[model samples]
Target: MIDVRAVNYTLQVAGRPLHILKNVSLQTKPSEVVAIVGPSGSGKTSLLMLLAGLERVTSGSLAVNGADLTALGEDDLARFRRHTMGIVFQSFHLIPSLSAIDNVGLALEIAAPELSQSQVREQASAALAAVGLAERLEHRPTALSGGEQQRVGLARAMVANPPLLLADEPTGNLDQKTGAMVIELMFNLARERGTAVVLITHDAALAARADRVLTMTQGELVEAAVTH
Candidate 1:
């Protein structure tokens, strides 16, 4: 679950403060899929970064899965993210040398230090299979296609079974059909595992698939009514 209230992010530019997020507030429940749609420079990614603990909020409160992100120190935030948050970035952040299974298994190994290497590998393999990548487990990112690479990314994110998933333009690099497939896989997996998702995307149709859609303009966020 996520609870964000009056969050603001400002950066120093040219000796003046530039506000990237303005009084943004939102909440998500477990297994809830929330989509954020916005134009370029609308601060959608900034909001995601704040939630993921990659960036600090200038003001306001953000709580994810009972952790007060706004109040935590850097070390605590990193630990929280490792144990509680799964992140999918537009650019697949896979290590070039590691195979898909290892990349995913690495996440599990990091998140659950108590797990043995064999246990991590088994869980990572399961995650890859869940995303339709059973046959490609041993393949490296360079050997995989854009969609396949993204699937590996997805598997890595979910391998830990974190309480919340944050995706930023997850399908941005893939073709339409591939993107759709990836999106479906992501939602299906999230639903099956009761993982709350906060998706940041530019595609309206993709946003429409979420349980709730929030539009951002000039750093402000407002929920949009779904039109059936």
Candidate 2:
């Protein structure tokens, strides 16, 4: 449901133009997971931000779920993101002042204020339960473990049932086994929901688990070896 074609992103840093993404082209289809694997400074995260419309593209086209992302004005992109895409960043990005339920409820609240307070509670509770955090709904991020916090993030992202999910280094802070479990749970749930996923990760083994893998080097995207 996502198509990126020959896109390039450039920025000026102290009077020098920095090319962060170069002619990158990739597509993510429903029920598929695409893992982008690259080293630091390889532009994987930059490409994700561009697709999420957090960064402006200097050239080329990007379409997510049929919306032309690069063509929209900043305001339109913000609306699109709220309704169509769910993003999980490296740092959970949870609101410290809000409880876990409120954090996830914020997703639903933005879209549907008509939903009753009890309805919001019910939906938030269901989402947290889905991510194995049913009992921690009342807790804050600081009160939860690293893995639990990420699960809560996933719950928030998936609560609205967005068609596309983008995660950047989601399991970066967890132990190997914990990371694998979180990755597996996230991918499995997304697939079950028929959501397209675009993931950025440095772990090759994690990338290998995806439906397809892409590599970035010096800001250019290259395909990985195809699995038969």
Candidate 3:
């Protein structure tokens, strides 16, 4: 679950404050899929970053899974992200040197340090298999196609089964067909795990598939409509 209220984000640009987001409020419950659709520079990704605790808001309250993200210290924020959230990036942020299995296992290792190596591998393997990538577990990012790489990224995000998933343009880099496959997998997996999803995308049809659709303009959350 996520709760954000009147959040504002600002940046220093040439010694002046640059406002990136304004008066943003959002709420999501378990197993709910919320899609944010907006033009470039409308602060959709900025909102996602705020939800992930990657960026501190300038003002207002933000909470995920009942943890006050605005109140957490840097170390606590990092821990919260590891334990409570999963993120899928548009760029498929994978470690090139590590195999797919290792990349996925690393998430579990970080979140649950008590897990043994074999346990990590077993869970990681199961995650990749869930994404239909059991055969590519040993391959590095460079060895996989764009779609395959994104699937690996998905496995990495979902391996720990966090309660909330933040995905920014998850299918932006793939072909239409591959993107559809990845999106379907993402929705199905989230539903199966009862994970709340906050998706940032530009695709209207894709946004329409969510339980709710939100539109942002000029750093403001201007519209919210239930789509399903």
Candidate 4:
């Protein structure tokens, strides 16, 4: 679940404030898939960052999974994200030096410190296997194809079973076929887990697949259409 009300985000550029998000309000329910389609610099990704607590809102309110993101301190925000949010980025954002399994396990180790090494490995293996990466668990990022690497990234994000998933151009770097596979995997996994998803993408057809489609322009959420 996510709730945002008239949220405004401003960034400092050359000592002057540049408005990024203006009067943005949105909500997502559990197991609901909402897609945000917008041009570059329209604040779609900024909104996702705000929802993830990676950036603080300049005004108004923002909450995800019942936590007031604007009110949390840095440490609390980090902890909240580790426990309640799963984010996938277009760039994959995998550590080059870490194996696929290690990368996924790191998330568990951070979020659930009480888990033993065997437990972490077991869970990470399962996550990777779910993404069709069981055979590549020990391979590093360089050893995998773009799709495989993205799958690994997906595995890492979902390893914690977070209630909310935020994806920013998740399929931007892959070929159409591979991107489709990744998107299907993402949606299916989210459905199975009842996770609320806020997806930021440029693909219209992809956006149309969501339960709702929202369009952003000039830092404002200008249109919202229910697709199903």
- Clashing pairs for model 2 are none
Compared with the true structure, what per-residue lDDT tens digits does model 3 show for residues 38-138? 99999999999899988999999999999999999999999999999899999999999999999999988998899999999999999999999999989
State the lDDT of candidate 1 residue by residue for 1-228, as single tens digits.
Answer: 889999999999999999999999998888899999989999999999899989998999999898898788989988999999899989999999999999999999989999988898899999999999999999999999999999999999999999899999999999989999999999999999889999988888888899999999999999999734
Residue-wise C-alpha lDDT for candidate 4, range 116-215, written one tens digit per residue: 9999999999999999998999999999999999999999999999998899999999998899899899999999999889888888888888889999
Each prediction's TM-score versus the true structure: 0.98, 0.96, 0.98, 0.97
Q: What is the alpha-carbon lDDT for the whole of candidate 3?
A: 0.92
CA shift of 152, model 3, Å: 0.5
Q: Flag clash pairs in model 1.
A: none
Superposition TM-score, candidate 1 onto the true structure: 0.98
Per-residue lDDT for 98 in model 1? Answer: 98
Error of 4 at 90 (Å): 0.9
Q: Write the per-residue lDDT of candidate 2 for residues 1-228, one digit (tens) a residue.
A: 888899989999999999889898887787788989888998988888888889878999899889998779989998899888888877899988888999999988775678888999899899899888989999999998999888888888888888989999999988888788888988988989999898898888888888898899999998899743
Worst 10 residues of 1 by lDDT: 219-228
- Candidate 2, superposed: residue stretches over 4 Å from native: none
What value of lDDT does candidate 2 attain over all alpha carbons?
0.88
